[model samples]
Target chain A: MEAIIPVIITSVCVYGLFRRINIFDSFVEGVKEGFGTVRFVAPTMIALLVAVGTLRASGFLDFIAELISPLAESVGFPAELVPMGLLRPVSGSGATALLTGIYRDCGPDSFAGRCASVVAGSTETTFYAVTMYYGAAGIKKIRHTLFSALLADLTAIIVSVITVGLLMS
Target chain B: MSYIFGVMIALGFIYALVSGNMAALSAGIPEAAASAVELLISISGMLCMWSGFMRIAKDCGLTEKLARLLAPLLRRLYPDIDPDSKAFGYISVNISANLLGLGNAATPPGLNAMRELRKRSGTEIASDSMITFVVMNTASIQLVPATVAALRKSYGSTQPFDIIICVWITSAVALAVGLMSSRLISALTRRGRIWKR
Candidate 1:
């Protein structure tokens, strides 16, 4: 797994050499463009992080998770993972924090911990993805992307719990 | 974006007032800003390196070659796009990078692809292909989630990779559901004039 990146870099460099391209110069050019990309996304990132952070700190996320906990438990999902699932799509850092908390409270090898790991691994931060991608194009009307992405996230969360239960036990 | 943030902030403020959690919310605002900067610092290096490599790849025609290899699938996903265009090339490589678990590397190509798509459509609203591409990305289609495995190992899991199969199952299911729903909703809304910009 670690070797994949080195392998890709080497292959790309070798191919660049074969094509007689100025690899270093081309790389520098791309890096400069990357700086612009970062600048472009800075506002979106800051705004999203602040909103998510405030919601998380104010306990609204836990509130929503608690509100949905019964429905989740009725469906066989663990209560502890409900918050993680709710935050998974909206905030990557918040979800990771919850995952770590789960690891501390329930040992990492426990059902809840394993389920959290699988859920985190399987789900993308859909809010971030949608915002960054569409924001880049200056597209305001995202239509159904958010709905579909959240639906996918829900599927992943449910499937992760079920799969972990099936395999772990 | 505006609606999401507006509602979120409103909820946070109201909840804080109701629960007397105003201190935490007040402190969290600046902390979130700092964390956002930290996040950017962490990812900026990979973003630069990958973007640089991508530039080299484009210069050497590797992206074009890769695009050609994935032409069949790309054609199906983005039927309106010409396979030889720059947008097609970026989209193909972006998906490839995401599948390989190169999350940071995928963003440059993704952003570039969005630019190209927007330019082609000449509109501020997202086109069908744009939504499909973003949805595909948001499905978390990685083959091996290295970060999760490493975190598990750090937490003393002897078999960190054991969940790989489960991860694969969940992600694949998510991707399938997301794509299907995206297509379904798009079709349903196409005739109704319901999805106003």
Candidate 2:
């Protein structure tokens, strides 16, 4: 599946040449704009990353996980995966690191590992996506976006546990 | 928001003080920024490559073709969007990229589409079309879940794509819930009897 990336680029370029498009110049233009986007993204990303790193390094993430695990387990979410579900909405990298940790501590085919993968697949970083899109567009009000996004993440988390339990178990 | 950031940092600092881990607190900021730069480098590489291919797709009429193909679906989802607008075209490409599990590829066009929608609407407040577009982008279904696949493979999963079916099911639910909840909230909060879709 990862190989599809190069296949796509090749297909797009070949199709562009067949259509008599100026692919090189247009590509360069896009490269510059892409660079600009990265620049815009970097500051916001750094701020969020620092916050997340500090929160985890201070044991806040573990504390929250410890507090929430029993409640989550009562509702069918594995206690081991609670940190991931909590951080999934707030920090992509944090959840990713925790995912790798889970994979290391538990076998990948284990319920917890499969459930972690499913959760990662099913959810997007809600506040981060909103901040990037709306911030780039300068849309200030952001009305109803956060609420709906959080709901989506919540549903994804709940469904991940149930889906893995049904299919992987 | 800054509220979340400030609270996290301030709490981290206080927590470190209480727990006597000032060393970790002091090191976190610089370390985070360094890693953020490394992430920026990786993300920029992917974006740089895909953005170019996306431009080629646009220049060669692939985007227009894709947009036309998806027109029926787009129109149903965004009845308020102009049928002939550039916003619709970019929106199609964005959704296509999202479907392929290449959201970095989706970002440039997605932002462009947002700009176009805002321009057409001519208001600081987000229009129904913009809200619909945002929800669709955020909660769009992913067939491949490529990132998760790659991570699982790195961690020695024999069948990393096993979760594809579950990804499909969960993301579909996410899209429906996000879209419906946004529309419901807006409809409820609007002040007049003339609320239009």
Candidate 3:
């Protein structure tokens, strides 16, 4: 994997230069653009982070998790995995924090940790990503996009969790 | 916000530790820290790779070629959009980026696409083309899903590739639903001659 990284980088650089762009300039431009995006997206990202944090700290997350535990268990999902589902769509970092908690509490190889891992693997930060990208772009209408992406996120979580549970177990 | 939660968790652990809840704190902090590190690594890695890839793709003329290749399909999908318009190009790139499972990488392009779309949209609150673009972006099909694979690897999963089937299935379903609903809504408005007037 380490060896492949250089090869991929070199190939990409070579291809870039071949297209009339100076590799150095392209790198600089890319970085500049990235920083610009971070600036544009920072407020929303921070707000989401704080909101998720507040919820978790206030025990709202735990309460919701507990409420959903029974339904989760009926579907073979560990009750602890509920936090992961709730967190997945909101913020990737937030979900990772929750997953880490589960892994620590339940043991990495345990069903709950495994489910969290799978859920992390399958899901996308649908709402957050869309909001940040579209908001920056000044897009006022998303039509069916949010609903569709969310459906994908939900499906990915449920299917991945169940599949991993069955296979890993 | 979630940072507060992390702080709270840390405080709770501290409280637990002082209260002889050593086991809880001992178990929690390390896990939380590990997950935070993993998240940071994944996001940074993805951002780096995608930014680099986009630069390379643009320099290679791949971005334009990609736009050309996608033009026919895009025209069909977004008939209200002018073929020669910037919105068409941006929409094409955005859709392509999503399809490649480079949604994170696609962010820059998606934003650029939306800006171009907005410019072409005039003063309309939400043009038909803009709405379709949004719907497409939201329902963007992902074929690669590198972020998920990275997360799986971080979690010590041996079979990260197993997620491919599930990702494909779910993205496909979502895309179908998104496109159908948007088209239906657009058709209803057209028949009512609401936007036509």
Candidate 4:
């Protein structure tokens, strides 16, 4: 992976230069654009982060975990996979943070961490990504995009979690 | 906005406490934060690649080449829009980006594409081209699942490639459904026009 990083960077630089684009300038421009995106997405993302934080602090997530635990168990989802299901939709980073904690608590090779890993690998950031991108673009007619993407996200989570859980168990 | 999220999160946390799972609540904080950082990094890398690739593609006349290559399909899918129109180009790029599983990367292009489409249509309501584009963009075929792969790597997975089948299946189904729905709606509207006359 480390080896791949330099190769990617070099390829991008070559691609940029080949187009008569100054690599430094393009890098600077890209970074600037990235920061702009951060600012543009800040209000939404910060709100999402805070909501996630408060949920954690208030223990709503655990209640969800507990409530969903039985159904999850029936479907072969481990108990630890609960937080992951909730986190998967809202924020990818949030989900990863949960996965890390599971890794720490259950150890890396444990069934719980593996389930979390599979869930993490299976799902995409559904609502947040769609909202941010569409909102930024000033697209009012998001139409059926949201519903469709969410469906995909749900499918990924269910299939990935169940398959991994069954295999591991 | 943050306040609303804060309230919601807090409410969730309170609910968890009431449910008697302090540990799960405790673990959620860092999870959210780390996940946020990881998402940002992934988005940055993807956007950078897209920005650079788009620039190169445009410079090399690849956009035109792609447009020509996709013109027949676009004509069939978006008969309402002129094949030679700028919106056609933007739509192609947006679709291409989505096909690569770079949906976030597709946003800028999608925005540009929509802007172009709107300019061509000159209407407030969705035009046929715009609707078709939306369907295609929404149903985008994802060849790679970058974010998922990254998360898998972070979680210490040895076989992160395991998700390739799932991605292929889900995205393929989504694309098919989206295309069918858009085509069905368009056909119905065309019939409605004849009925009204």
The lDDT for every candidate, in the order shown, is 0.80, 0.74, 0.60, 0.58
Best by TM-score: 2
Error of 2 at A125 (Å): 2.4
Winner on TM-score (1 vs 2): 2
Clashing pairs for predicted structure model 1, backbone only: none
Per-model DockQ against the true two-chain complex: 0.48, 0.45, 0.25, 0.25
> Which has the greatest DockQ?
1
Docking quality class, candidate 3 = acceptable
Lowest summed lDDT window (length 10), candidate 4 chain A: A1-10
Off by over 4 Å in 2: A1-64, B1-67, B191-197
lDDT tens per residue, model 2, A29-139: 877766776686667766776776787677666677678778877777777687677778877766766675577568667788888888888787776778777776778
TM-score of each: 0.67, 0.69, 0.65, 0.62
Candidate 1 residue-wise lDDT, A1-169, digit = tens: 3465567789889999999999999999988876777787777767777776778778787787688779877888877788678778877766765675566557678888888888888888888889899988999888888988889999998898889989778
Tens digits of per-residue lDDT for model 3 on B62-98? 6567678988988898887788876666677777766
lDDT tens digits, residue span B101-189, model 4: 44445778778777776666555555556656655553435454444454455556565445455445545554555556656666777
Docking model 2 quality class = acceptable
Error of 2 at B48 (Å): 13
What does fnat come to for each candidate? Answer: 0.79, 0.64, 0.21, 0.24
